[model samples]
Target: MTRIAVRHLGPPRLTAGLDGAARLDWDAHRRVHPEPRPLTAARLVALAEEGRLHGRGGAAFPFARKARAVLDAARRRGRPVVVVNGTEGEPGSAKDKVLLCRAPHLVLDGATLAATALGATEIVLGVTDETAAESMERALAERGLDGRARVVRLPERFITGESGALIRGINGRRPVPPGRKVRASTKGVGGMPTLLSNAETYAQLAVLAGLGPRRYGSVGTPGEPGTVLLTVTGSARFPAVVETPAGAPLGHLLDLCGTRAGEGVLVGGYHGAWIPGDAAVGTRLSREGLAAVGGTLGAGIVMPLGRGTCPLGECARVVRYLAAESAGQCGPCRLGLPDLAGALAALAEGRDAAAACETVRRSARMAERRGACAHPDGTARFVLSALEVFAADAARHVDGGGCGRPVLGVLPADTDARLRLEVDWSRCDGHGLCADVLRGLVRMDEYGYPVIPGEPVPARLEDDARRAVARCPGLALRLVPRAQRGS
Candidate 1:
């Protein structure tokens, strides 16, 4: 795994003095950031509530409310299991990994505090990257907390980072969101209620515990107090994770990265919406602030699109990637994502302009709110926002072929080149079950054989699509996870 460079702006709360350094040991970490003050479960909840602290994770859920629920559930069931979700699945986001790698001790401090508050002893730190896992393990050992805290290397899938999915993976299940609505807080690992928050959430908790609510609330917006770590990538000269105060202007961050906002910026990751760069300059980086500008600071990711790259092409490529990253569970996500991706690709390639846009709009409408997880909704938001934000470029695509620009491929498509879906031709008996179940993806060829899309099956339809495969008389359908051929 490649090492991500870390940096910070303003007084760094989570990433102070750790920038330019590889890893901060327990001693070094303590030297910089003060030790977390002990807090009872009630006190921690009170502090979080007072500070208006939100989860650094994309959902931006109230940390206090989530923690209180876990505590309540744990009291009723069994000791709660505290999980540090270091499985940073967002391709464009690197702040979690930065914390896990550079400030593992800080993250551990927060996790241990939360665990102690809930009277739980075990800390299960979930990391996707092997290096991050090792860093966490070493941190635990260095702090003599290795026995209490265990690091589990999890599957590095997009959906696996979801709280439920992380719990499911830790419980030795496939790293996918549950089909039904099973709250991890109520029924989590080992049938016990779990306290699962991402690595950044724990780190922020540590910061809050150390600084106290009043001091912690000094920097950021009134609604969302404290700083946020952002993985500033794309078009930026130095694409490092920078800790910035909440509600900072988008332009200030752009200036720090030495990136001029060209077409627009993709705030949040691929699941996030796109907004006009000029208009985004004044947009605040907080969740509420960005929401005011019709965008979200999801996962605290900001990617600028310089004029060198074709906006349509870049959007199409990322949409294709999002389609491939689908969990492949529900019908709408499976069929709708690829349809939307295809429409975007068509628009990018300057083909079937009007029809492609129409298909994209229709697919977005169909895909939104149709999946068990938020993948479909998030991806739909991304694509739909692109159409609205880049209206001029979209019109050019619809009216003519394109803006006559090449796909610089600024956005990462490395995962897209990894895996795809395939069919066992000999096993297929033309039962047409898969075609019927996955009509959005699978169709019957002239010979009654199921025709799977050449591209990877959108992950959103994995569950139902798998059911269709199971019902196949010949067991012909299989979703290939890793890439077998070049994208």
Candidate 2:
């Protein structure tokens, strides 16, 4: 694939000297980190404190706390392990993958630095995309870490990159949240302390180590130093991964990408909030900057929902996708999300549009803080932000039909197809047995026939689905793939 354009709005740290499609080899990586002084645990912590380094993977979590926790845990238990989260599962975000593919050695250098400082026994790069995987492999091989460091491929599911899920996958278990909090700082891979962080987070650390606190803190706001890598997509001259100083005006970056903020912009990723186009003009791209403006810099995904499309329809589609992507281990995932998606869909379709907004709000509240992962909460945040930003459009859609616009899918998604439960009408009579087997997923219609959701079946309900399919007397009920669903 051709390399994405890497533009710089202010001084560039992450994307420096790299143009479109240029992969940095070992030599280039060294220039970025020349004879890096090995950091003592305390010194690394101090540096992190000075720089105020934060994770680039959506959450904007402080990197110092995570590192300190791992250090304390290691001191009490044993040396920690370093895991570079190259598994970019968010469809709207490509910063991590771009770093992995274009600046592989820089990422490796950061991981190696952390590993050495912590006296880590292992280093693993968990990658999802094939291109990223190949690039990581080459970087490791070039550094002669083939024997020491390992690269593992992970599934492309959205929540698989969650810290707990990532550690679980590295531990030879399914890459899903353990239905409970599993702190990687204390109990991680092989039940040892693990310093798990996003790829860009590590790359930032490498930069910090090389540039030190004063030089690193020279740019951006004092609260958030250095540059941020963002995947800017939609309503643009070109969709590209951009690097800009932390406090740089959000509008400048949008202009650099040739974006026309038709409606408001969807700041962050699918799980992030939206900002009004006017509010975005002077908004900062940093965590503090965006937060002050009531938006998130999640996973560094910035997409402007341009005109010529229905904003509610676009949001509905994303809400449905988020609901489908749920880890399926929580009540919110099993019930609340689907309900919320339905409400949003109803509003988008102008079916009882007035009530649908209220329904959407209620569902979002119900879905909050009740999930194995942030999927539900993030999904809720996404929809609620939409409701707030597009209140006028929603009023029109509710009072009238739609805004007389098409969906036009400006947002990117893995699949537009919803998982559907189907029945073979010719095979046999209506069986209420399927409804009995799957309680929440399948129900009975006016007739005795079963009515199942066209939304994707909850991952937690796979057993129930199989049971329903197996117990069918005439083998009439079956699970239909999206490819078969006419929708």
Candidate 3:
């Protein structure tokens, strides 16, 4: 196997010296052969039809269909814009950053070709972290394609990378979605038609354009034929990026990661589901294969939960962090997520495990589709999966005092420490003013302590929420931002 040199800059990979144009290191794993040639829209479309290329960005939408949508919409109107989603806000996934830092030119080649094919005059590469954005910017300069493509910084929040939110951010608005549903392909970035896809997807397109379909299909499984970059972290000997065939076995990846047999595997990132330790079942890693087993290969984030840490406690901590990260744009997500987090915390504290499980179910149902974005739904899936996968742990917590092991904090937290508004039960006077003033922001529990919603207060309602914070009769409620919480 060929290994690409990558400079690890904390959670993301950063390239060195991006001030000027630099050549991408593609000698080992070039997706295309015969020295990539520029492909036009017609040829690209035909190749996509033949290769059956799909989005690598978890959605798995057909690439041909997306391209056609942009083309048709542009013809209906005028020129369309191509947006490369390199933000990769999924906490555990770093594949895009790997590609950007190591093989930056591959991504640029793909984006440029796609822009030309779609008749898009402008191309924007949306990246969140400073390193990846600079790497891509430098790559564009190396190719002397600076006039054709521009790189934009994306918001670091999880939901900010969604196509709609990205387009909204590009338009000088906050990187949050509007209340109503909107399609970017129809009206995006300055109200122009947009073709948006994952960074890797565009890179794959460049490869296809250069190599043609038949050659590109030679590597992976028939249904999903190509090489995929997977960031295999957790319990692995070498926790780095691995270029593997799309349908490579989960068992093989686990072995490569140096995980002991019988350990649980987190197939996807935070929003993904967990699976059992049967290595035999780890046949393939594609979306279809994972879906067949009621799981998903979301962004190719595979983490193995090693022994010694309390799985239940760790999962609860992750759930709490995910809850606090909610954008809080809609009623259900705003109301449901924190409650679910509370229940998970309760389970961690050795109280009401069964009831907490029920609360998780209820909260998930309430928050699923009501949010403007899919953050709530994805979070619900993650929490629900944890409940199912760790039934024994839940049972132990309910029947006994608690899970014996300490929380290892394998999952990332919203703050450096726990983020909750503490009510000095002794200091509390049941004025109900907090609830009255901030109905959506704070609700009085049975004991009169405020059960604050999980989502962030909308800009419109920020003042009202603050008013409730100020009007607390006992000065009981305090709004603690995640940064101040220290984890």
Candidate 4:
């Protein structure tokens, strides 16, 4: 595991000091913010606009408009609800988690402020990470806010953090995106207008409320004022959670994290585009700044694909994980995503590379705008961007047998890459029997090949697992006990 490196390029408001993890107790937290001041609904919305605050989540949606919408809904409907989205589900992103763990009170202050202004009696904080949940619980306890706020543990799947999905999970429904669009602001938890925002976004709000826009907006560019937290990982010397003012040079961040020269960087998260090494130079960090360079400041996940790693293969690994983690409710999840994953896998393996590349592009196109949520569109962006950015490698695989470079597994995925259910890809013939006999333990991918999750077989299923292994005609399957796995 890489050691986490936390650094701040400017004055550290969010992170208390250079040595990160500002675990401030209630009294200490009071020293930081002096407690939240009362702000009317319209005043809060106006402050968000003046602060130029956008969601720290991938979308970077304007905070003022969303708050106003929730306020309007409350006027027409009933008193609103507030949900602090602490479910940092993106495997590549950790900024929200870092804030939840280190500055729990900061996030709570923001949430409490929003809840009070919106006249929301309930402030449900949905957190996927147990540690983050624990941190919020501790912060709430310290503040003696047991009655005002509550914490709900959410599933850690890739799509479970979507607003509707999180609301569903809170509402005791399965934590998957709805089959169609359901605006949370209009009808969220218990059919009340909900003011839901990412945890970091709320923290930004708290900061804005405290600083009153002018001092808060002093550091960053005029358009995108205030500092932003970025999770810079992959191929960098050390994984970093950096707090830098907006409009900082993208190259500077890459260099700050020790990103190697001439390596492609995946801007945003898996749902973001890839920028070439040359293109990354002098790129800025704001929404427009990244857009000028064909990039998006998605969830603030930035990773440089290291030299000697097969970028396409690494992307395939993540896409495969993404496909398997789908809600499986819409056409994209049921068909398009699986096909995209399989096509990318074929491209990575050099099997029908020309046809596979075409299929990959076509699958991405087909998946867009055909889903209940932005999952499909975001996934399509990830796939099409890879094709465009890694065209040279695709061309190499198309003409030649394969790219000589190996997939370094640099990109993170939800699946644990443990030594458990093992398959000799060289010998596997898509038997389809493993899935039928083992049932949930082993499932077949779109290509009829087994898509074994990285989990140890349960003690009760050991015999069934062995039977499936024995039944494999090509002798391609086996289960390794945890003892032998060096766990």
TM-score for each of the candidates: 0.88, 0.90, 0.84, 0.88
Q: For model 4, how does the per-residue alpha-carbon lDDT over 378-441 read when each residue is reduced to its tens digit?
A: 8899888888888899899899958899877788864533336788899999978988776544
- Tens digits of per-residue lDDT, candidate 3, 1-487, equal 1232332221221222222323354432232223467777887788888887888887778888888877888888789998888888766677788677656777776777788778888888888878787777777776577787888886677777877788888888888767777777778867888988888888788777765788778777889977766777655556766667778777776666566524467777777887766642465788778887668877777777766677777777676666656676677556677677767776766765778667767877777877887778788888787777777877888888587878776654443232334445565788888777755345566675666644344444456666776777888776666445422
**Predicted candidate 1 versus true structure: per-residue lDDT over 1-487, tens digit per residue:** 5766676668888888686568899888889887877888889899889988788888888889888888889778988889888898877888998888888998998998988888885999988888898898899899998678798898777887987788889999888778887887888878888888888999998988888888998999898889999998988898989889998888898888888878789998888989888888888888878888789888888999888778888888777777767676777666788678767787887777888888888999898887989989998898889888889988988888888888887887556243355667766778898878875456565577765655555545567667886788887666566546522
Q: What lDDT score is found at residue 86 in candidate 1? A: 89
lDDT of 3 at 71: 80
Better of 2 and 4 by TM-score: 2
Number of clashing residue pairs in every model?
A: 15, 1, 7, 1
lDDT of each: 0.82, 0.83, 0.70, 0.82
Q: Alpha carbon lDDT of residue 280, candidate 3?
A: 25
TM-score rank order: 2, 4, 1, 3
Writing each residue's lDDT as its tens digit, candidate 2 over 349-391 gives 8877888889999999898898888888889889898989998
lDDT of 2 at 280: 86
